[model samples]
Target: MIPTDWIYGLIGGVMIGAAAAMFLLINGRIMGASGLLGGIIDGTGKANMKERLAFIAGLIGVPAIVYFTIGAPATNVSNNMLVLLVAGLAVGVGTRMANGCTSGHGVCGISRFSVRGIAATLIYLLAGGVTMLVLRHGLGVI
Candidate 1:
């Protein structure tokens, strides 16, 4: 039998896909988190400040509201601040180099059958698997 968590995951994935579709159709923009946040930070999103702000607000606010209402979700992240900071910076740089992130490449890009998106998604999955193998088994640092 399918696990309860798998059902929840399926529902969440559907919701995310719907949200991405709606964002693209209504805003005429890809719902990429990295691009959205980067544009705001770099002042490139000034022309659509309201829309960007609304998107960001919803992104952050909805999760906070959900956590408060339904209780905080569990995480298994390392407590090391430096490790977290380095990881965050690495992801930022990687996304900038790739021209998009998981949301853009995996969801929006793949849905539109984009070559770049498919390539980036594959690279991301491969890199993630390698990282996990190295960290969890080779280094025992995870």
Candidate 2:
């Protein structure tokens, strides 16, 4: 039997792909969440503030609404606030350095057969795998 979590993941993936396709078709823009938010915060997306705000609103609002209505799923996140903060900062910096996040490179870039996206995705995956190996097995930090 298929697990309920797997079903939810498939549904979520389909929604993400559809949203990305629609954003590209409608706005002629790549729907990279980090780029969208970063542009706004950095004053680089002034020309499309309305659109960006609307997109961000939907991005945040939908999940919030869903959680309020249906309750949130459970997860085992680390209790260490320092670790969480450091991880968040690391992801932000890494995404900026990479010129895009997983949504941008992994989904949109790969769909368009972009070499940069493919390479960035491969590098991040390798890095993440190595990090997990070290943290979980070597240091037992996780």
Q: Candidate 1's residue-wise lDDT over 65-102, tens digit each?
A: 99999976688888999889989999998997787898
Query: How well does model 1 score by local distance difference test?
Result: 0.91
Top candidate, metric TM-score: 1
Provide backbone clash counts, one per model: 0, 0
- Candidate 2's TM-score reads 0.93
TM-score (C-alpha, index-matched) for candidate 1: 0.95
The residue-by-residue lDDT of candidate 2 on 6-102, one tens digit each, is 9999999999999999999989989998888888988989999999999999988998998999988766888999889989999988897788989
Clashing pairs in 2: none
lDDT for 47 in candidate 1 is: 89
Question: What TM-score against the true fold does each predicted structure earn?
Answer: 0.95, 0.93
